[model samples]
Target: MNFHRTEVRHRAVARLRAGAKNADVAREFDIPLGTISYWRHMDRAKRGECPGAHDPKCPRCDGRELDSAAYSYLLALYLGDGHIIQYSAHRVPSLMITCDDAWPGLMNACETAMRKVFPDNSVCRVRKTGCHNVKVYSKHLWCMFPQHGEGKKHERSLVLEPWQQQIVDAHPWQFIRGLIHSDGCRITNWTTRRVGGERKRYEYPRYFFTNTSTDIIQLCTDTLDRVGVEWKPARQKSRKAENISVARKASVALMDQHIGPKY
Candidate 1:
């Protein structure tokens, strides 16, 4: 069997992504037409666009039962620190979430949720200076993440569809966990007190979620309320209502049990 070098194959795929016809790419690269077609097929399969062989069987497209728990969690991650890039008809879109490298477990969980949500698609991680980009390319991402739009997440009007709302209701903790992993954190505040003639340090743990999108913030707080977890507006130095706090002892305990620290 004849084989092309890695660089040649990459150029061929780049041509395909640029809307060049298979035969044209084959002619330009001196590759067999059938081989070019196979390459195209494999690329589409990796993106979950191929049917039967590797299709993701998108719930919205094929009426498959959506993995509600995973979908809810991924949705929170997308809302918090992710973005979807729209592509032309010839190419598939990509979903990317930036995860801190310090929390390798969070990166793994994020990739796991993506795989569960888009079962047949391949997820990849790209490393940055201090973080990793967990990404998946698929034609059906927009169908699943309907909140994807033209601009930044906070700049756009975010609303949940009825079906998505149902999932959030069912797996509120999972959703909260994803959001915390993406844009929230659990921190400890300590103070030294004199007890029995000795200085003792007491630590208080709390959860905080910060987001500029009012709608997303509302969604998080609403889910917190549904689960009987209390939260309040967290005032920052800016004095804006973009921060949320779960500081009550009981609420913090619940968060710790369900979400915990990033790692």
Candidate 2:
């Protein structure tokens, strides 16, 4: 401990007391982590600080004003294709959403929504073989995303909390948009038809949302019904999964106005 200057120790302790992580303080001050932890413990003891201090950044924990629209959309994204990972070395959990490499706009939208949901945290993008994972770290992820649990999401119950349901109900379109950006697609279907005794080609655009969880599919269909969008359960030809289709011209138009194709 004496190897480090007294001023460095003071600075490290100050940062540690101000809610900075021991690892961050150690790296910033070029001090061993064990020494930093000891110094932090001493500083906390001397100041009579509580050991179990709750973070005020959490809306559920601290009564902060949650961004309902952003949270609703993010909730849909999480339920659709996102996941929260708790690392062994990290006390906080990370929220991650996989975005297709082809849709740069969709990736930007996901990152923006995450930032809006957690303005104080840093968001990062990790590159994969053909996609990018946008992630943000937070201590109260389970509080925010109560739907997170062990095993795949399709296997567990995904009942939304009362507050979360309120947000979704208030911003149904945004929720639908996020879900579409995650696991839904807008495609054009075409077929040949006889018109006026001649062969003619006809094409139509529609939206399809596919998920392995029946609960999530039901949520999507419920929202669609709430918004007066006609939808039907679609059958998969090559896979066993639940899918919802918005094929009616009016419904497609409504979806286009509110939640268009992923970027």
Best prediction by lDDT: 1
Question: At residue 25, what lDDT does model 1 achieve?
Answer: 99
- Model 2, which residues run further than 4 Å from truth? 1-56
Residue-by-residue lDDT tens digits, candidate 1, 1-263: 46577788889999998999999999999999987897899788778787766555789889987789999999999998898875444457899999988999999999999988888788999989999999999888888889988877778899999989999999999999988998899999788999999999999998999988889999999999999899998777554448999999999988888889988
Model 1: lDDT equals 0.88
Tell me each candidate's RMSD, in Å, in order.
Answer: 7.0, 7.1
lDDT of 2 at 63: 81
TM-score of each candidate structure, all chains considered together? 0.79, 0.81
Per-residue alpha-carbon lDDT of candidate 2 for residues 1-263, written as tens digits (9 for 90 to 100): 14666787888888877889999988998878988887887567556675764343889898887788989889998998799997543146799999889999989988999999998888999999999999999888989998898999889898889888889899999999988988899999999999999999999998999998888988888888889999988878537588888999999999999988876
lDDT of every predicted structure (CA atoms) = 0.88, 0.86
